[model samples]
Target: MENPITRPRSVERLVAGQATSDGAGVKLTRVLTQDLQRRLDPFLMLDAFRNENPEDYIGGFPNHPHRGFETVTYMIAGRMRHRDSAGNEGLLGPGGAQWMTAGSGLIHSELPEQEEGLMEGFQLWLNLPAKAKMCAPGYRDIPPPAIPEYVDGAGVRVRVIAGDSGGVAGAVRRPDTEPLFLDLHLPAGAGFGQALPAGHNAFLYVYRGSVIVRGAPVADRHMAILGNDGDGVVLQADGDSRVLLVAGRPLQEPIVQYGPFVMNTAEQIHQAVRDYQAGKFAAAAVQAF
Candidate 1:
């Protein structure tokens, strides 16, 4: 029997994401940093946006370019219209997800599909290794029905987006960074636990209600960095808690970032900008919807 007291994993650090805006005046919270606090390698940034006021998010993300990395957009509520220069288009509704690998380069935009109501979602940036950074760009869109869900007798629910839980797997497959992305909902007085990949960098973001991670308390809107020694994660709901758990293997490579471009060297960063201006990025704009 597994000892409930020995959770192996515990909160090592906690950070309250800073307030920031990106992509044509869209408001959101920035969870990861590009500076010293960048303990979550391979995983670059996490932007969480939730607003009841339509004016706060109607602007949405305008046309933008990205390269040498991948972006995962998971929608919890509301609808977003995505259009890429590659001629790909889709309406991402509630509980949908889009994983875009901007290998080489790509231009895309995510605009609000509606004019009013609440909009809540998360956009996570995953770094590509030096070798795979310039690979062919591709994308995968997973609708709400396509994503698998699991529920225990205790009323604890889990939605797997990019990993496996209790033998049920997520929709995202073979990403450059082997990622485990899970949405967990624990009802009042409920507890949840799961085994994590060994040696993976993991963290928990509590977005609703309060919870206990390992032996520490985590409130809403806060991120908890877990120690690497843990082989699994444990949580207990203080109320009706909701959280997102993400883990990935660190690349441990040089990361040179400039705007939407992420590369290993400064020279590569400048070349990306020059290539975009020279229309070289248009190669990714294939006429495929």
Candidate 2:
């Protein structure tokens, strides 16, 4: 029998992350910024925040406002409490995730639940097209148990957060974006391959050990932007490796972003600022996803 998997997507380029601070005063590694390299359509930013020192993340994220995009926060360790102006509150512990869509606008805060230990997580920003930018503001708070996991015979485990993997689909329900966010752990010498939407843009971020992505080596804290020509990605573990794979459809529309706002034009950005200043985020008004 012959294998049907598509040719593995190769790495087009490697992006080195930088140290940065965000969310009140949280220290983090800015892995993929919107301005770096060519624009990664539909994805605005990717930040990895991991620290053993409480001082590094103790400040947490104070109340803040966002509009025109979605923020996905996945916690691998520690606990975070999220509260929004709509009176909705939730606690995200290890293996938990939160997908908050700030359509027109919203105000929220994420604070640490404990004093110390190993605090680690990733916050991803996904862009919305012009039609859905101001539709409604809503959120999906997913516990660890809600996320789907797939394990292969070779000891490779995949946590599917927003897309299908190994025939198992994630519980995250974002109709407009329909993105794929996965965390993969492969044992030493194990290999993994999965098909992806051909039209979607994809990238891989390695945060542990080393892995061979489409025949190219990717070490810790490095990001590999995959070529768009392939329909799937193949990776092999040089050692015990952990990585995050993210992909989403490109809107192919003009994107103008400022601070927490993302829009199609400069005028829309100014309007968003004025809307925030007028205290429009006081109400939850988050629309159903």
Candidate 3:
């Protein structure tokens, strides 16, 4: 599909993270959202935090409430324990993921489980469909091994987390927006391009190294939002660069966000909270195909 946006240019967005305690008994970093207003459809927020010092991490996040959305927590280093009101419990290590669909409502929290005090991870909020907004809650905790990762040796390493990338399909169940994630690392001076379907929005986040997009240079810790209209995306690495490509079809829904909750209307958001508080949340039923 031809992209409506021109060849991707490197535009930098603001960056922000949160300070929280986890398993290791120390404080760590995490993200909330870079700029206000939803830039990506279906996706409402992105948080990235990293800490190496013991006291800087380890305490972990305590119990919190969520409704009308899906919370996806991904870990790249260290360990985290997950416990929720739905009776889901697990530990996530490097490459681990916990995808929880908090339909009507659910309360949960995550904390670090080790004493090293070093933890790094991310949590993303995805909007649920209106019809599914009242569906019962469900959980999916997948280890790093379940996610497909391979080296494209011509200097590309890819980890397919949700959709097909380089013939590798992410093991996670497809969501409403059909999200695609790729952990791409390229050699210095290498140029990479991919064919992206029309109507999909893509962004490149530089975890490390540097890249020159459309004659513009972007460094580490900066996120590049690509134009949605174009044939594909071209990223040229000026140095050994490691980046995350998060792409999904735009969600054309009205978003009314309040703190940790995202919904289509203020009344709907208010009703969601009331349902949870009144112990009236919808229960997840095991449906057979």
Candidate 4:
């Protein structure tokens, strides 16, 4: 059996996300904002949206530009059609994901493929290192079957999205940020553990139900930032719960962001803006079907 977290980290604080709308006014909760970028280095933002009403998400996201970071869109329900200037097009359905690296720049749109029912998912912005901020843009469409998942003896199911868990590797991996993204579903009264580097910044966002970490209750739609003093974390489900566990090694470098552009300095941000305005962002192509 894989070794469990011996010293589980405690919750540093609980954060109530701010309700916001983006991309043609699609309603969402911005869980991680610009203010927390330093504390949660390598991760810029996290937006969660769950809407049953068609009016809330029908507009979807129109053509937008991004540079110097990566966008990971994971869909729990509903379907979204992705098209980009890189000549890439794909349909993201339930249990699928779209990973786009706007390394240098790109123009993309994510429109709804369905007219009704439930629309739920998250969009996470992971910052790139200084060295890779201006690299070639890329994209990947990861279907549900491509993602590595495992069910533990305690009836806890874990979907490893971007890190190693329970001896199962995720579909994508990065060396610089070394991000760990896991979607965990735990049964009532069950527990789960995952080892993490003591130096990495980590947090847990509970979505379905409540969970307890280090004796602190994390309610639905709330985020619990974990302390970095321990080797890992232990979570106990207060009920049948679904949570997102995310961690990454801090870049420790300067972060300067302007809208969808994230760079190391203000000058770089300015350059990105000028480049996008000059139509330089659409030059590169990413074959992401």
Candidate with the greatest lDDT versus the true structure = 4
Q: Which segments of candidate 2 are over 4 A away from where they belong?
A: 1-4
Worst 10 residues of 3 by lDDT: 280-289
Pairs clashing within candidate 2: 137-286, 137-287
lDDT of 2 by residue, 133-246 (tens): 997788888999889997888889899998888888887756655699999988998888878787888999988988998679999889999888787888888999999999
Task: Please say which candidate is ahead in lDDT: 1 or 4.
Answer: 4
Badly placed stretches (over 4 Å) of model 1 are 1-6, 36-38, 285-289
Cα lDDT, model 2, residue 134? 90
The lDDT for every candidate, in the order shown, is: 0.84, 0.86, 0.69, 0.92
Candidate 1, residue 128: how far the Cα is off, in Å: 1.0
TM-scores, all models, native as reference? 0.94, 0.96, 0.85, 0.98
| Candidate 4 lDDT over residue span 48-157, tens digit each | 99999999999999999999999999999999999999889999998898899999899999999888999999999999999988888999999999998999989999
Candidate 1 lDDT, 1-289, residue by residue in tens:
1113354599998888889888877889998767622578878988899988887898889988999998999998999999887878888999999988898999999999888888998999998999988887887788988889888767888898987876788887555468889898889878887787777889989999988987799999998988887778888899998899998888889989998999999999999999899887766833211
Which stretch of 10 consecutive residues in model 1 shows the poorest summed lDDT? 1-10
Best TM-score goes to which candidate?
A: 4
lDDT of 3 by residue, 177-224 (tens): 787777777888876666566777667677779887667676776767
